[model samples]
Target: MKKEILNCEKARSICIVQTLAKLGHFPNRKSEKEAWFLSPLRSETQASFKVSLKLNRWYDHGAGIGGNVIDLVCLIKQCSIKEALHLLNDESIPFTTEAPVSYPDNSGIEILSVKKLQHPALLDYLKSRGIDYKIASRYCYEVNYTCKGKKYFAIGLQNRSGGYELRNKFYKNGSSPKDISLFKTNQTSLIICEGLFDLLSLLSYSPTLATIHDFLVLNSVAYIKRTTKLLTDYKAIYLYLDRDNAGRKATQYLLTQNPHCKDMSNLYEGFNDLNDWWLFQKQQSG
Candidate 1:
């Protein structure tokens, strides 16, 4: 008998609504672009989870987190990405019989322009964050986009799903298709961070450490459940989350799942986060 092995990327591309249906989660209501469901992650009387067929993603408004099919599976099954893939692979039944849905006409936001990180205002913002100009240029871009008929711009950090997390002095939000930013170095061990700035701070302060291991930035605490599943292959998962309530809770959750997961937040014991610690060190040297 030929064994059927599942491809992780292929499995992730599967329609989320279809997958949810396979797991007995039919949508409570549907439109051309979105399907609403009572959140499968948590028990609630009202439906709060929305699946965007146009984007092939899901966002639980109550949780304030969103991601792709892999993330959805991880959230639903409480299993690692590899384990979810395994379970999905074993199921031989077709998840959906319908034809591919067309891309929706109204995406709500439009990318007006994308260019190199050369804007003075954005450069100054990076300086304020204590991130080096060279480092910022390598991982970020200057993005201009339109939403609700208004134009805006921000320093954009692209995630694995081609979505950008936008940040500026005045505005802080993510563009559609919210997802985690992953830097894969083919290393067995990995270090996970909570934000892009934190990852940059680590790179600036400890370039050697940054290069030696892979990195994953949660971008938001709500992503912790989905992010945990991606860490299964790492031999040592070092968490450098902020010393805040959300961070502490996420770290505890990961530790519970894998007792060997290391908590490196002690390195900045008295500070708010890695960036805060790095800024303090810079001030002290001057």
Candidate 2:
């Protein structure tokens, strides 16, 4: 038998819909569960893109297409199912078998727990991530709570379930588990990155590339096993992994798996990734 997929709650917690909405997609509104936005699928005027907050669903009035959260991300991002969850961290959502209830009791839920975050603290945390306050404020919030005998902070994102995704701002780097986000549009070229931050950081360095080529964030070396298939479909593949041992190993492994995989590591041999390389270049120029 095949391994069972995680629940809706778990899926919702990690999905980046909230972030995407806040960044530029969904407009902020209260009372109504539906949100209006410019259709990401196509450019049009008059805000035909609609997202349902209560149902955690979305629809493009212009395109006459509508779907739940998962459907929207898959279409918007053009990623595989596994890669989609990895990109959005949709696995962060939490759910149980119990029937619908007014309030959920989040005592020992794993992954990201939204019940522990402080509202103001979360806003501050987003600022630290270099995400604009106004943008983040539109989608994220801090959940109120006291856990055990001590107080804990969590970043809350709305979900199909009543719970939120909670990640502490102070966790050790690389301590958290890794996930991959892969996308392959019909474009002729492919651009890869080490992680989500690095991928997003690329937007700052090469804004044009963001729209011109299909992008993939390996999320980690572990995901390379599942990425070879994506390689076969693209005409050109670029490896933008880190300069460290793990990144090198991943890049080499990919080449071995698919002869088409290119070692673009030369572009950032000095730094860990494009972002670091860009930052270093900025310092040198200054």
Candidate 3:
């Protein structure tokens, strides 16, 4: 079979509805139209999933999964360029499935120009995402790209390799390594969270912790190997994984491997992560 190139617009149109329907944005004229079912992806109880044929959308409250037609196709078919187009063309599925024509993959693409760190458009996106560009600038830079004669810029983290860890207003790319900050404070206290946001939230809320506590942000749980040895050194390491399944699993796995470490998830039991807990506190205060 010949390789299939996708028409971008068609694929996008086809995917938007499916994603919207899955996200429960679909309009339901009647109670029956709000049909509910168990999530098809993960095993769970309760019919949190709903479909809105009238609005041509779907939503699953339990999983927090929502998107448009193109996103749904990407999730369902594990889309490649050709597959995305093919799925869009199939009328058996709801909504139009057409996408702009995609060019061949140039995997070994090289950098053309590096963008300015303080570009107004770039800074605006960072502000919207709750990231301070001043802080982000310490670790990331910007780069420019051209597609079909259009110019765009992206912020990127420098990797060990010369290539950048690229992220833009729309997307993020590359991998972030697990980073652990160790301090031997007399208080014998330590904290751990999944990402920088959570750590910053914790620091912002707990002024008392500034005295003698060390912290770590396991960039990816997969990098746990780099952290296992460091856990042994801390007198009371706090496992502050997210409240989601991945977070719970990491905490559980760490306890199994290093029983001496303390689990800090109890500090924010109801919420998903440290940042979530902060948001909760912010809401409660208001």
Per-candidate TM equals 0.63, 0.44, 0.49
Quality of model 3 by C-alpha lDDT: 0.56
**Candidate 3 per-residue C-alpha lDDT over 190-228 given as tens digits, one digit per residue, 9 for 90 to 100:** 676765556556666765665677666554455555678
User: Which of candidates 1 and 3 reaches a greater lDDT?
Assistant: 1
Top-down TM-score ranking: 1, 3, 2
- Give the best candidate by TM-score: 1
List the candidate numbers ranked by lDDT, top first.
Answer: 1, 3, 2
The TM-score measured for candidate 2 stands at 0.44
lDDT of 2 at 248: 86
In the order shown, what is each candidate's alpha-carbon RMSD? Answer: 17.0, 18.7, 11.8
Taking the tens digit of each residue's C-alpha lDDT, what string does model 1 give over 16-39? 998888877878999998999987
Worst 10 residues of 2 by lDDT: 170-179
lDDT of 2 at 161: 30
Note the Cα lDDT for every prediction shown.
Answer: 0.78, 0.55, 0.56
Q: How many residue pairs of model 3 clash at the backbone?
A: 38
Stretch of 10 with least lDDT, candidate 1: 99-108
RMSD of 2: 18.7
**Model 2 off-target regions past 4 Å?**
1-169, 172-178, 282-286
